[model samples]
Target: MEMSEIQAARLLLGGDGRAGQAASRQVGQESASVRYGEVKSVDAEAGTMTVLLDGQSQEITLTDSTASTRLKAGDRVKIVKQGQSWVIDLAGGISRALDTAVSEANARMGAHDETMAQQQAAIEAAQAELAGMDRKISDAVDTAISQLETPDGGNHIYAGADEPTPPKDGLKAGDLWYQTNASGQIAAVKVWNGTVWNGYDMVANSILVAGSVGSTLIADGAVTTAKITAKAITADQIAANTITGAEIRADSVDVNEIASGDIYCKRLTATDGAGYTEMTGNKLEMLDSGSRSLVAIWVEGGVCYINANLAEKISIGTNSGSVLNISNGGFIFSSMMPGFRVNGVSAVESFAIAPGSATESFSANVPYSPHKTSYAVVYYRCTYTDTAGSVKFPITEGGSANVVLKELTAFEAADESIALGCAENITVALGNSPNKTFAITRGNPYRFAIKPSGNSVNANPGSQFEITQVTLCGQ
Candidate 1:
């Protein structure tokens, strides 16, 4: 027999015996009961409400509970809805349910907003961290590129400084260096002098580059004018005479005491045989003056050489004995000569044999010998060393440095191998006249003698010959 507040309101408001009717009508109907009235008086201590209706005021008893709403004398409110009954408004069960639902909804909204805010903050933090890492990685890559870009040229020392040389293939602010990578790439290059890292750094090592052919270490485009020693010159590096970035000007260069234009400057001080010879050019200002007699001549391609007033021809191979024997008539004359003989001051010199002498030609031809063929010979004694040697001048196996004399006694006619041979000693003999006295010795100057074997009438036409001087290491 528990009654809801709506039932109680029905009992209080519906006529005393009309409860059953109100309840029956409200069973399936969605409705509420309300009354219009004015508050006449309120008693705080008694917790009661006195409302006026139709000029009459009635005192109402309030529930003894803290959750109930208190009304003042002039305030107005509605009671809870009841079963088909009209009643005055006041705080009741309906008000409590609404209050609870509104409070729960507000708490849930606050919690949801806080979670969303936290998630947004986390996303922003992650983005900032990623940006910082990107910056660090970029900086690291830039540093690596700079380190790799450093040059690897040979080292150059300053005038008066005591700093240790930089790594051969590493970065250097001031020093001379030339180094390459495994692929023959120019990895690092540096040259340091007294003041700055420019101009005075382009001094060549030995008038030649130390890299292999097609290596690109000292190719044509690698050198420029700013790296030359002379600061006032219009152009410093000659691309045509390309070395490395350290190429010097052709006009201002000297190699082994021989100037660029084959002009003799002084006695060459080298680890091999050294001497000087004057060469007159048939064409004035030829690319090669043919004077220095060094293998590395600065001659342009497709140039012609005309030896005017030259007599006798001497042509020989690079691999053969030195005895160039020419026999006919009565004796055998050999062209095997010595090491150092003054070119113009030798008793035996090469000259074109004049025609007409048949039975008695000058270097007497042995009768019924090896035909009337002409011959030119050079004596050679090879010595090799294996100690401290240069690439161009390699050491031999004896551990006592020496030279290689590829013997070429007979002259070739055309397109012959143009390489030279080195010689330190030579021996000769003439099987002819009863008093054939030809002396041979070392250290004494000598030059190859060019002579024809057959009679002057039927000599080898165009008796051309070549005699290469073998320069020894530590000579």
Candidate 2:
């Protein structure tokens, strides 16, 4: 038979069968020291191999005794040193070692996963505890804010240094207490009537006993006029003669309150006997010892009489109206005097005269006694044409334009010739006419005449000369 390659390699090494076998056994033992590497190169015919050991390339001779001849580049293999030569083999042993390493790595990964889960659970627990703490803190803050006495909470009433404590409970209707009012000031005693507290002033409610002399309840000057009701005090309440002249206000007493016959005197005459004597009657009279009444006041009738001549003149009415003026020498009634009645019949004659033509003359007969002094006032209006003409109008009492009379002589003589008075003349311009009035006093039968100035007295046609209204007043 042909000798195997291993036997031929042993003969060349000069080894007999037994010695070769023994040497082979020793090589195999040495080759059992295995390490993992990668095959870098392989040459099957040369029986040479290059393997990477410890990150370095190493040459290996593949003898016939080598186990695998199918090694190729990039193949994981097991390398062993055998008697000054390296041997390359299939990576069976390496594969077994890798399986063990894989098992250890998987165990470590499982442990890491367990640790991460535990850490996550701890984080979640910490978050939950933090949230609970936050809620507790918020509740505590809310409780503190609610207890404050600000505008958002309780208003107006808060205990201060000088203020009273606010009532908290046990409230009843009309129960009295104290608190701050709406004005933020300490109020007077306030009453509670189920719903709200009502404030009241204490001083205004207190009452004082009448006739109590020395009571300290009311302060000095505290009682004013506003506090007293109308007619609160009567005469019975006031002490006798307690009010003085200084205490009584001016004009406090009315005239109606005084009793009649309160004023009296012993005599009207002075001690020097220069005044008149007082006389007793229904009238208040002052007289001389000769029993002649000098002055008298009729108290019941409200009339006054003077027997003696008065030093000053008396004026009865104002200047604008009828005036009955009495002087030392005489008395006169002015224009517009209302006539006196005789036996309830109208004694005075009044005329509402219409305007006459300027060319005509007008006349009126007045009831006048020739022996008695009488007065007449004439009011006339004259209208003229637009021409340069002058007109003189004369007011005649009798037929003549001029009549003379002495007033004192007329009254003394009582003769008609002495009583008849003169006529007065008033001139008017035709260009600018105006109203005129005049007053005359006479004691005669009178006929008033209005005539033009010239003998051939003719007014301009359609021109008006009139006595609109005439009042004849006498006393």
Clashing pairs counted in every model? 49, 1
- Candidate 1, residue 82: the lDDT equals 50
Q: Give one digit per residue, the lDDT tens place, for model 1 in 1-475.
A: 3345554454445322234666554322322344434555665665555544322233343343231245556545444445553445555434654777899999999999999999999999999999999999967754453344325543333221223344456434555434445553545554545444443244443234344343324434454233446555565433345455534445335444433544344333334334333334433221223343322222346764433223233333335543332212211123433322222222232312222221111232223222211222322232211111111122221222222223223344365422222222323223333332222222222223233432122222111211222221111
Question: What is the Cα-based TM-score of model 2?
Answer: 0.22
Q: Cα lDDT for residue 104, model 1?
A: 99
Off by over 4 Å in 1: 1-20, 26-42, 50-106, 117-125, 128-475
Residues 1-475, model 2: lDDT tens digits: 4344454334323233234363653333332355565666776776656544443332333453343466567767765556744455455745765887899999999999999999999999999999999999967754453233435432323222233334475444544444545663555656555677676445644456565543524555444222333744554234332333333443234333434454455665544565666657866666665656666655555655544433355556875565665554344344333323433333233222332432234443434423211233344333321112111122323322232311111222333232211222432111111222222322222222222321222322222433334343323
Give the candidate number with the greatest lDDT. Answer: 2
Q: Which ten residues in a row have the lowest lDDT in candidate 2?
A: 428-437
- RMSD of every candidate to native, in Å, equals 32.8, 36.6
Q: What is the C-alpha lDDT of each candidate?
A: 0.37, 0.44
